[model samples]
Target: MTLLDRLNQDMKQAMKNKDKETLSVIRMVKASIQNESIKLGKDTLSEDEDLTILSREVKQRKDSLQEFKNAGREDLVEKTENELDILAQYLPKQLSDEELTSIIQETIKEVNATSMKDMGKVMGSVMPKVKGQADGTKIKQIVEQKLR
Candidate 1:
């Protein structure tokens, strides 16, 4: 089944189980997917686009969690963690640090990225390979560390 199909099934399950948090997050995800489809004037999004949207949503939650934590808001951090956990279920398995490093090295070589000036080239090449399987911020940090 497609990601959308799976998400639909999960949403039904969440409703049946009366899981408010899970249901809310699933509904938000569905709404976002629908918005993107509307933007493109399509009935459904491609799986790649869905993954991209899911990753972006998860990243946003992570950013919020960091902000809350920095402000010593433990309650908000706990809620964000739960939301993050729900969001993570839809993402692909994340890459390990060693694996990410190797991929970044290969991307640098592929792009002939010898300096920070070529960071964009390296990022463009690497993102496609790592999308849905790695965090963009972490990937950028790795690439910068390698370049420096």
Candidate 2:
């Protein structure tokens, strides 16, 4: 089933189960997807587009979690952490550190990126291959460490 279909199913289930937290996250995601579709003037989003939206949602939550922690807002931090967990359910399986490092090494070799100057080249090549599977910041850190 498509992402929208799965979201719809889960939304209904959440409503039936009276899961307010899950329901709220699902509604937010659905609205984001709908907004993207409307912005693009399409009736449906492609798999890549859906993944992009999911990744964006996950990234936003992660950033919020970090900020909340930094501000010592324990309550908001907990809520953001829960939101991240819920959003992760829709994303692809994440790449482990080993897997991500291996991919970065391969891309570095492919692009002949030997220095930080080639960071852009390495990142551009690696991001597409690992999209939605790895966090961009993690990938960048690995690339930087490997290049150094």
Best by TM-score: 2
- For 35-81, candidate 1 gives per-residue lDDT tens digits of 99999999978889999889889999999999999999999999999
In order of appearance, the predictions have TM-scores of: 0.96, 0.99
Each model's total of backbone clashes: 0, 0
Stretches off by above 4 angstroms in model 1 are: none
**lDDT per model, in order?**
0.92, 0.95
Off by over 4 Å in 2: none
Winning model by lDDT = 2
Q: Model 1: what TM-score? A: 0.96
Evaluated at residue 9, the lDDT of candidate 2 is 100
**What local lDDT does model 1 show for residue 1?**
80
